[model samples]
Target: MSSTTRAARPVPACPIRPGEPCTLCQVDVTGPQDCGLVWLVMGDDELRAGVHRSRLAAPGRR
Candidate 1:
């Protein structure tokens, strides 16, 4: 066991069944603490496939 291995883990494709490839990418973000958050992103066909994390509720900027 190593820090790199512990920090990162492969996320298995969801609903693995029949004949279908999953549209997913996985990366492990970890360090000294748990930062209670997980993200699901939708890609954009415009501008190099930009990524944005959807807000849980009302969006605010400061």
Candidate 2:
């Protein structure tokens, strides 16, 4: 058998969804860095807080 090496692709993390990687779900953006939904959610103080709270309340989450 022959062995070949391939470069590892870096997985970008989701900014709003803690401990989760970006899934590239947005059609207009490449990743979480350029995601409009992430920007909008993060831009609002209340929304950001709500996301944080939800993350904390998730089952099996630390």
Candidate 3:
């Protein structure tokens, strides 16, 4: 008998939250494109600013 395995594809980083991988944080979301959180954050300047601040605080800036 022969068996084969396939490697898992790497998840792309969250565009709304820079420098962060898509962790499937939202149960309803399959990816950033359909994520409600991403939509909400992006729609609000304050919330989007917060995400930007977090990315800037990380060790290596994007």
Candidate 4:
């Protein structure tokens, strides 16, 4: 008999939720415009949208 194994999915290093602020936002970047995290998040449409929605829902942002 043969058995098959499924590959494990990759997880993000940061603990923040999809709609929450990313690690980049939590830190001080020397070049905010060139933030790698921003690029990474933007690569995923759902995640990027969630982040934007979260930012808009944040307190005092209104």
Taken over the whole model, the C-alpha lDDT of each candidate is 0.28, 0.87, 0.86, 0.57
* Residue pairs with backbone atoms closer than 3 Å in model 3 (clashes): none
Tens-place lDDT per residue, model 2, 19-40, is 7889987887899889999999
TM-score of 1: 0.15
lDDT of 3 by residue, 1-62 (tens): 99999999988789676788998899878998898988998899998898888888877878
The number of the candidate with the highest lDDT is 2
Off by over 4 Å in 2: 1-4, 59-62
Model 3 poorest ten-residue lDDT run: 11-20
Worst 10 residues of 4 by lDDT: 11-20
What's the TM-score of every candidate structure? 0.15, 0.70, 0.69, 0.45
Better of 1 and 2 by TM-score: 2
Clashes of each: 0, 0, 0, 0
lDDT of 4: 0.57
Tens digit per residue, CA lDDT, model 1, 1-62:
65554555643322221122233423453421222222222222332133222222214511
**Shift in Å, residue 22, candidate 2:** 1.0
RMSD of each: 13.8, 2.5, 2.3, 12.2
Point out the worst 10-residue segment of candidate 2 by lDDT.
53-62
lDDT of 4 by residue, 1-62 (tens): 99999998543333224333334554565333556676677778898888768767767653
